[model samples]
Target: MKQAVVIGGGVVGCHIALELAERRYEVFLLERHSRLGMDTSTRNSGVLHAGIYYPADSLKARLCVEGNRLSREFFDRTGVQYRPSGKFIIARDRSEISEIEALRDKAIANGAEGISLVPQDTVQKRVPCVRCVGALHSASTCIIDTGDYLTTLKTLLMQRDVHLLYECPALAIDGGVRVETPRGSVDADIVINAAGLYADEVARMTGLDDFTVVPLKGDYYCTTALPLEVPVYPPPNHGHGTLGVHLTPTCGPDVIIGPSETPSRGKDNYDIETPFAVFDDSLRDMIPNYEAIRPSLREGFSGNRPRAFRGGTRCEDFIIMKQPDSVIHLLSIESPGLTSAPAIARFVVKMI
Candidate 1:
């Protein structure tokens, strides 16, 4: 059997490893941390995207739409818990209505299922507290219990007899076929770089240094104060950096809010906290009585998105490049990554 070495134990890496193992390859998965899904995988909102945000025909758009279907199937097959709560992109005024209508057109172009424009009265009736002109509802967007999903994936990998190496960082790559970790050296027919924030550095070790991973930090807040039944978002932020502050109904009671986007000090920097005023202003825009629940908006966990840049220009789509000696590098896998993990694994395996 051919041997493969997969770096990073995030959702993407684990999925890739499982695919390789099932294909009859001797798979060895390496992780820098002690557990899986510890970084960008489990952080931020756990919303399963319906591929509505990206440009038509982009890798993100295609994979996310396909992945959403695949993820729902996988969850049902594995008996993993998830909430099909859907999502709402609301326009508070007439100025934003055109933007949401455009998004509906784009969603149609991207083949995202169950996307429709809801009338203002219908939206208000469903979400009484939300003040909006109208809303774009994505029926495929759901909230998955991230921890449960990861645990289930891990169990599947173990069942396949894939070697799980935790706390073993891939320090270097010799000739793109040998992975040198602090634990030991591993020789394989294929090597996959899914190292999340450190993927660029891993690529550099193999002399593929054209891309850089810029960590975009986002902070979140949580509260049980909002009676939101599903995700409530603003029209997509035109800045292309973030989706702006929105409220997500978790699988549990607390509603998550405010993944305020900002530049990080470094890849590992989560110390920079955003001001409360930022979230307050954003919440007040969508909900007029936001100040009443301001006291309940407590700080929550933060996550960093591994945004890839090439030649100082940001790469908007997911990068899955194959190199000599069967090395595959996955970069700029943010946002829809969690939703696209299964499709990404199948896509990477096809490269072999």
Candidate 2:
């Protein structure tokens, strides 16, 4: 049997490992952390994207739509906890109505299902507290219990007899597929790198140093105020490198907000000192009574996105390509990456 080694225990790596195992390959998963999905996988908003963002021809657009469908199927088969909570992209002013319409067109072009533009009255009826001129409703958007989903994937891999090597970091690649690890060396026929924030560093170990991973830090805040029944978001702030502060209803009573984006110098930087005013200003226009609940917003946690840059040029789309010597590298998989994991696995399996 051919042996395949997958580095990183995030959702993407787990899916890739599972897919390879189903294909009858002897799969081994290596994780630097003690448990799976401890990094970017469980961090950030757990929304299963409806593939509304990204260019029409990008891999992100294609895989995200397919992944959204496949993820729901996986959740149902595994009995994982998830909420089919729909999402609304709101335009707070008349000037932004055109942007909302553009997003609707893009979502339709990207094959996203159940997307339509709703008038202000409909938007207010759906989200009572939201003050918007217009909105693009995505009815298929759902939020998954990321931790439970990861556990389900881990259990499935174990049932398939895929070897799980925890706390084993890949140090280097001596030969084609020989990975030197802290525990021991693993010689495999194929190597897959899905090492979240450290993907570019992992690639460098194999003499592929064309890309660099720039860590973008995002901070989340949880509010004691009543949670929305659905998610409410604004148009993405492409210039600031983030989807502006939005409200996401978790599986609980409280809501999550403010994944304010800031470029960081290192990957492990999880500082929580980001000014709340930034988030306050962004949300004031969308949430009518924002000042009344401003005191309720409290610091939650932070995460780092591994943004890949080649020759100082930022790569906006997901990078899934083969390098020399039968190695597949998946770099800079952010945003819809969680939603696109399954589809990405299928795509990678076909490439092999």
Candidate 3:
């Protein structure tokens, strides 16, 4: 039996462990937390996106579509509660109409389904409470109970006889090196690092060159009511570190908004004021005619997306290492990372 170790109990790590076990590898899922999906994975917008946002041929674009489809299926088989509560890429002003059309065309090229442009009147008819010049209706976008999804994945992996060690951190690791944990040290043939916040630190310990994981703090808001039948997103402003702040109606029925792009020096760094400021700016842009819509002040949470630590470095694909590639590190997995977990797992299995 081949002994493999996966670090992190987030959705990505759990799925990767599940996939590897299916491939006949003895998998061990190592988690620092006592429970799974407690960090970035559980706190995200939970939107299963179509492959519409990224530039053509980007890893984000391809993986997003493939992952979205795989995620939908995984939910059904595992009985994870999720909703195909489609989405609207709202066009707040006249300038956004062209971009909406372009996004629709991009979806076609990327082989995404049920994506099209809708006019202002149609948007108003669909969502009477809010106003828009037009909207990009993504019928494929959906919301899932991410925590439940991860729990189900963990259960399934365990049923398949995969070993999962909670409260275990990969203290130090090198290429094909033994990982010393709180529990003990174990030699691994393959080490999969899906550590969301600490991916860079884990990678560095491996002695690999050419990549770093920078932690980006995104703060989101939760509304008290069911705001929309589906999520309400803004037109993509390419080059922004994030999709502009938007509203997502969670599977739980509470509407969520504002994952404000706030840069930080470390992981899980909490700052309430930054999200508050960005929420105000976002509300002004999307809901200007708003009274009931206010800069939502609530007990919102924050999670750090692990990407490149620098401003200029942009990574658009999954970095899988096995052979000279015996280790795979999933870094800066934010946003669609939740949606892409299932497909990313499959891709890693094939790569090895």
TM-score of 1: 0.98
Q: Can you write out model 1's per-residue Cα lDDT over 218-283, one digit (the tens) per residue?
A: 899999998998889998677855788899988888898968888888887776488888888889
What TM-score do all the candidates reach, one by one? 0.98, 0.98, 0.93
- How far does residue 166 in candidate 1 sit from its true spot (Å)? 0.3
CA RMSD, predictions in order:
0.9, 1.1, 2.1
lDDT of 2: 0.89
Q: Rank the candidates by TM-score, best first.
A: 1, 2, 3
lDDT of each: 0.91, 0.89, 0.78
lDDT of 2 by residue, 3-67 (tens): 99999999999999999999999999999999999999988888999989789989999999999
Model 2 pairs whose backbones collide: none
Give the lDDT of residue 68 in candidate 3: 91
Worst 10 residues of 3 by lDDT: 288-297
lDDT of 1 at 130: 87
Ranking of all candidate structures by their lDDT, best first: 1, 2, 3
